[model samples]
Target chain A: MIGRLNHVAIAVPDLAAATATYRDTLGAKVSAPQDEPDHGVTVVFVELPNTKIELLHPLGEGSPIAAFLERNPAGGIHHLCYEVADILAARDQLEAEGARVLGDGEPKIGAHGKPVLFLHPKDFLGSLIELEQV
Target chain B: MIGRLNHVAIAVPDLAAATATYRDTLGAKVSAPQDEPDHGVTVVFVELPNTKIELLHPLGEGSPIAAFLERNPAGGIHHLCYEVADILAARDQLEAEGARVLGDGEPKIGAHGKPVLFLHPKDFLGSLIELEQV
Candidate 1:
């Protein structure tokens, strides 16, 4: 069910600044920013050796990231993403184990153009987990 | 100057149960368990694509992980590990940027026998980050 770690998403107050911090200061190369209209957020990707770090900023006041930032003023980690061999099968297994998953019965296309589904934090010991099929 | 992500360590109360949960339910294969005598904790690894998930359990009453679990009984996501190409260079850069590092000026050999250092959560907007040189 679990494949590889897809990416680690961090909620940032400013995507550009965060991206710049990672690139200029940390020497990490930055990928072009992308706006996810569905999620009402803009994200910048910083590629690392085997994984990528996603810096997410809210595009609008109603954005989910905005609400998350509000609850966590320091803008901590948002979620952990794990690659899954089969999203539906993984979802079924998680559901059978009584884990609460976000979204309807379908997995949506995520920022990386992969099928992604989120599991509620309540189900995973307070960690918001995303399952991505790669 | 990061290498490849070594592993993402999650602080869990029950190492055996967590290991079982991941294996029996998620279909992730388990690796042999190892105890970090220096850290006063035991750990189990679950290897995935490109990375591994470490389940940490405190070994003694005064273990640091025990304190962490007390604060967050739900056992949420603990920290993110980034693989650095050069541990010293990366640590210097982070320190120059005013990030508070946990270890004293030197990276220690972690569970996987890689040089590792931890940055304070205060410096990373409430997210604890570990840098590992693989």
Candidate 2:
């Protein structure tokens, strides 16, 4: 079963500008930024009471974040994450149910070092779903 | 600060079918249904651990949900809600920051009897944000 909401990911064209807006304007404290070389994306997290807001920016030209920005010019919500008891188990369940997993076999370190796996939006009615193990 | 994620609202063409999918397919328990005459929407709530999923269907042809469904035929996510300490205070802050509130004046009882208000998508980039008070 899915637990609490882990975070909401937002795809942004400019990470610095988005971080500044979330921090200065929304009063959300920005966490240390991290880069995922495999995904070719950089992410920063803003912690809230029971969830966080993840800001994602493309690291290179051909990254998925870049494609997402191209598709959504206004820089909108990318995905919704829910905490799970076990990342691999959730991945297996989703895969068995014909959901496409973005990453390879294993779960990877997501924002705030949480073990995370993403299920493709096509399988979930246009809403990207992420499972994170806390 | 926001307490937790109150719910994620999805706009669907068929409320009964959506409720069935959430209950049988996803194993989520469906809450009692409610209708908002002012918004022209009939909604069903699916309760999770910390957050609920709201399936919104239009009551009339000219309703906002109808317009949203017309814009996205496949049935997409509509809004993300955050639980606030005080709905009115959050609404006031958002309004002072130039965010447009769709409803007039006071907070009304939303799904599950929570006082709620919606911030227009135009005010928050392209994502619709709802503030709910528990």
Candidate 3:
């Protein structure tokens, strides 16, 4: 079962503009851009009182977000991450319930260096969901 | 300044299926459907530990989410709502920074009965943003 809302990832075409919009325009504390080469994206963390908003931009060739940005040139909300106590157990339960786990159905070390798995968007009302073990 | 993330609104094509997905599949505490004739959408709140996920379905002839659903039949993330200390001040600051507020730039009573204003997606990295006074 999901515990807390970990973060909402928004894929943006221009990382600097997105960061400025959140920091200067919206008056939120934003972190410097951090490149997650393994994840094929650069991310900026927008810190809120309760949760985080991750601004993502494509990095390197075949970046995961490149296709998403192509579809939504202005960028858009990419995925929602929720914290789970035991990700393996959660994955098993979700699988048993006929939910498709993405990417070989294995938990990979996520951006935060925690085990995480992504669920199929089709199975989740067209929204991509990530489950991270906390 | 934006404080807490009020909620993430997801517009779903099928309210019942989306509710079941959150309650039964994801195992989150979901509220009963509430019809908001004024907002032209029926909503279900999926409660998480820190924030809420609002599931919206079109209701009435000119529902705001109707076109969104038409573009994304499987449903999708519609917008992100952030809590602000002073709605008017937030609006003024955002506008001063050249960010366009949706509608007439006046705060409307949101579904939660709080003064809320929507920012244009173009100014917010292609994502709809709602600012609620808290």
Candidate 4:
């Protein structure tokens, strides 16, 4: 089961522009951009009271966000992350219930240095759902 | 500018099936479906500890969710709603900062019976942002 709505990620073509929009214009407290080589994306977190808005940009040629940006030039809401108390339990429960997990059906270290897994968009009503243990 | 994440909406073709997926399979607490004629959509709220998940299905022919589902046969995350202390003030601030407010720039009564306004996707890194007075 999903716990808190962790963060909503927005895939953007330009990290600077997106960061400026949230910081300078929207007056949000944004974190410095951090590149996650494993995830192949650069991220900046725009902190909100109860949640966060993650601005993502492609870090390399094979970055998944690049493919997303290619299809959506303007970028868009890339994914929604929900915090779970026990990710492995959630994964096993979901798998038993016929939910497809992305990537090798194993948890990977995410941006927050926590275990995370992505659920297939097709299985989740076309919305890519990410589960983060926190 | 933005407060808590009010809800993440998912546009689904079949409300019943979608509701079942969350309730029966995911073991989530789902609300009874409600129709919002003005918005031309039917919605069910799935309550989470820190936030809520709003599942949306088209109510009429011109429903926006209908078009989204047409493009994506499997449902997907529709929009992100953020709670604001003062929506009108927030609207003016965003407008002054060059963010185009959708639908005549007026806050319309949303499903929660609260004033809500949608922002153009192009302005917010292609993510359709919704502000709701809380």
Name the candidate that leads on DockQ. Answer: 3
Between candidates 2 and 4, name the one with more favorable lDDT.
4
Candidate 1 collision pairs: B1-B85, B2-B84, B2-B85, B3-B83, B3-B84, B3-B85
Candidate numbers, best TM-score first, in rank order = 3, 4, 1, 2
- Candidate 3 on A15-130: residue-level lDDT in tens? 99999999999989999999999999999999999999999999999999999999999989999999999999999999999999998988999999999999999999999999
| Shift of residue A31 alpha carbon in model 3, Å | 0.8
Off by over 4 Å in 1: none
Query: For candidate 2, what is the total of clashing residue pairs?
Result: 0
Model 3 Cα lDDT, one tens digit per residue, B1-134: 99999899999998999999999989999999999999999999999999999999999999999999999999999999999999999999988999999999999999999999999999998889999998
* CAPRI tier for the interface of model 2: acceptable
Q: By TM-score, who's the top model here?
A: 3
Two-chain DockQ for each candidate model: 0.65, 0.46, 0.90, 0.72
Off by over 4 Å in 4: none
User: Model 3's chain B TM-score?
Assistant: 0.99
Off by over 4 Å in 2: A95-115, B1-3, B103-109, B112-115
Worst-scoring 10-residue span by lDDT in model 1 chain B: B1-10
How many clashing pairs in candidate 1? 6
Tens digits of per-residue lDDT, candidate 2, B78-121, equal 99887788877777776676668886857888755678877776
Q: What lDDT does the true structure give each of the candidates?
A: 0.80, 0.75, 0.95, 0.88
* TM-score for each candidate, following the candidate numbering: 0.91, 0.81, 0.99, 0.95
Error of 4 at A10 (Å): 1.1
Poorest stretch of ten by lDDT in candidate 4 chain B = B20-29
